[model samples]
Target: MESGRWDELERRVAALEAAAGRPAGPGEKDPTAPATFWALEGLRPQAQGSGAVVYAGTFRSEAGEVDWQYAHHVDDLLGAPDAVAGVDEGADRGDLAQVAARLAALGHPARLAILAAVLRGHDRTADLAELLNLGTSGQVYHHVKALTTAGWLRPAARGQVAVPAERVIPLLVAMGVSS
Candidate 1:
């Protein structure tokens, strides 16, 4: 890229950052920060300002082994406005610990499979055990306890377990089971 284009890109990113109310200093933190859209390599701003921005950019895989170019609207990229809105900036250590625990609960393959089974309507403990081919019901319940304690699963009426309604889409999206 030419110097002029690079400078323009930097200026635009700065403007976008400013408009989004991001703090200027490196160590400064904002409790209620808005979503930040990266102007990745080869990104071209299509339209900006007016409470929204559009860009043509490459979405790179984690390993940088693949890249897909697509035009993206910033709002759409951030997901549902209501979902992203009103986020508390004052999240403390306890909040972070809870998040870490929740993520850790999904780290095990058996736990992930169990969650997937529940998502697919296999809510019974015996059914989940059979689906995963575990040796005993105790093992299934152990994983179930982890998931339930992490707030991913809840006991339904009878002996079945379920993913809470509000968590269904978020969990599936996190697991890459849904877009």
Candidate 2:
């Protein structure tokens, strides 16, 4: 990483630590980041039986930046006694079939290409077809429809399409892990 980039990151860390009523300095616990995995530490106590998992990160793109963290104790999915308290009865709960449907939507090569193109600023169906050399605009629309229904992409102004901001990191992370 460049020195300037590190400097900017340190500055941001200093600002965050200052807000948290701590000082940022070398050899001291980074106030901006916990000395340990805060998410894992929190999950370990409550996650029981089948165990738990967590995924989180900061993502940057041409469109914008996103900070995200998510965790699920397997007990929660199975409604075990160890589940998180106050979960809505009507909550999606990431049931197996629903998650499979969403994952299936990204299984297509064309859909993945469309998502990648849109993230890189080519949001138009025609542009995506041309840029990715996938197929006709109609076929692009087909892929776009699947992505939209899966909540991975959305219809934008002037017939363009976009990945919703919250979905951006997940999409990139999914793609990265698959690769």
- Best TM-score among the predictions, by candidate number: 2
TM-score of 1: 0.49
Point to the candidate with the largest lDDT.
Answer: 2
lDDT (0 to 1) per candidate: 0.69, 0.80
lDDT of 1 by residue, 5-53 (tens): 9999999998998888876578866656643545532343454432343
Model 1: per-residue Cα lDDT at residue 86: 39
Clashes of 2: 0
Residue-by-residue lDDT tens digits, candidate 2, 57-112? 78677767888877777766555332224344344444544677889999999899
RMSD of candidates 1 onward, in order: 16.6, 12.4
